[model samples]
Target: MSAEQGTHTHHDDRATVARHAVAADAAALDQAQRTASPIAGRAAGAPSGLDAAYATQHALIARRTDRGERVVGVKLGFTSRAKAEQMGVADVILGTLTDAMGVDDHGRYDPRTAIHPRVEPEVAYLLGPGVEDELAEPDPSASIAAVAPALEVIDSRYRDFRFSLDDVVADNASAAAFAIGPWRRPADTGPMDNRAVSLEFDGRLVQAGSTAAILGDPGRAIAAARRLAGRHGFALRAGMILLAGAATAAVPLPATGVVGAEIAGLGRVSLRVGDGARTEAR
Candidate 1:
């Protein structure tokens, strides 16, 4: 074979290998989600590089969509330095959020199907139409329809809630469920930075921090989401909700109790925890 032709063939072979790896990783994660079983992190059928991991992520989300789950938006993870340290991952990651993953404000969060669940406080953004274009400009505030105090319930599919960066990315950033509070116009919420954020379980404060922990300001998470989405070839659409990552390290979700999150100016949002599996809260 000619030198250039040989190089082209080598690239094609690598692409084929990555494609098969992505498919295998996606299928393993889908099985784990369905059976509520924890697979060995990275040690099992996980793709190697970030690119393959993201491809696996999209494939995993495709499985959910095939089963009738609509993609509602995207979520940024590891935006908080502390959360990244806790997870042993330094880079930021994004995950797909589907309609089936949302819980109404004040609704019950049943964790029966989760392997090990945790809850964290967050700032959420409601995006308007043409968000993709607006986010490309110097200031993207115009594309933000509203902001809210939010909570995310993350349940890693890996055993013991352990995984490497690529493993978690392929597993869709451990997205299990989420809740958002009342929406307030962006103009009314100030800059959405420096707001006191806290998570309470059964009326007791368990985790506390500030919105500033979310990539300096929660609004910055929106920009980060846009960039990550573009990198993954995912489009940001109108009426989509953007979770800006946790303000504090997540705490174990209770078995049967009210789990709430509050942002100083944005008000509070909560979910009633349901113990469908009779597993005790950690």
Candidate 2:
């Protein structure tokens, strides 16, 4: 083929690949939205297929980012060894952040938009300043200095609460929406390495755990978030809220329930989950 023809062919090939990637991403999002279980591989009988389902997830986040959606922060998942082993995965996964997914210190949420929704007691951190690329190493102290305590509300869009590691990763680490508590400055506490936490449902203690539940320390989770963001060509910014992985197994909320979580140093955040009810800020 002539030079001009070769150039045109290359451009066409690039376009075709881009189109396929976008289509795959959209289909994955649709499956999550519809609560449909995506085929494990390309086909029912096919042995080897897509190796990384989260690639489609990354594409979905990219599309949103391209559309001027600011990434508020990152979320860490599968931090506990027990949870990781149960999920049949060795390492944890990360998810991107969006403004629309955030809830105030005292806010409410609807259950209709989520599939297999559950609430996890966690310690969230708010970054004080942006962490640039060069300084993105896994420094727990520096990362912790940029963190604050809060809670996270997670809801999966998977059918029957069933999914493989790839499936969950593609579903944004099963994150639908999250709620933050009153921010507690890291400096206020002296060496909060392994503090204990408790979660109460309707004024009754439901679950208890420690910061050590998250990779020995919540700071490590923050470091993981930093590394993950850097790998994705992004940086953790000031005012960003990072939901460290769950301190304990997620507690499944019934259709109608009042949930509240209390961190050691941080204040408490409460929310009401209901079916077909609008979320009212408390």
What global local distance difference test value does model 1 have?
0.85
- Model 1: lDDT of residue 42: 50
Which candidate wins on TM-score? 1
For residues 1-282, write the lDDT of model 2, one tens digit per residue: 999999999999876775575457546564555453433332121112123455556666776667676678778999988999998887778876788677665566676666657788777777654344355566555555444455566766554677777666666777767777666657776555577777766677889988789888777776677766656444577667778888878887657666778767656777776644334334
How does each model score on TM-score?
0.91, 0.80
TM-score of 1: 0.91
Worst 10 residues of 2 by lDDT: 41-50
Task: Point out where model 2 deviates above 4 Å.
Answer: 1-22, 34-52, 62-69, 144-147, 275-282
**RMSD in Å for all candidates:** 3.4, 4.6
lDDT of 1 by residue, 1-282 (tens): 899999999999888877777887898888998888998865353447888889899999998999999999889989988768877776789999999999998887878778899999988888876476843562558668889988999999999987888888989999999999999998887877798988887778898899999998888876787778878877798799999898998898888878888899789998888854232233
**How much is the lDDT of residue 107 in candidate 1?**
84
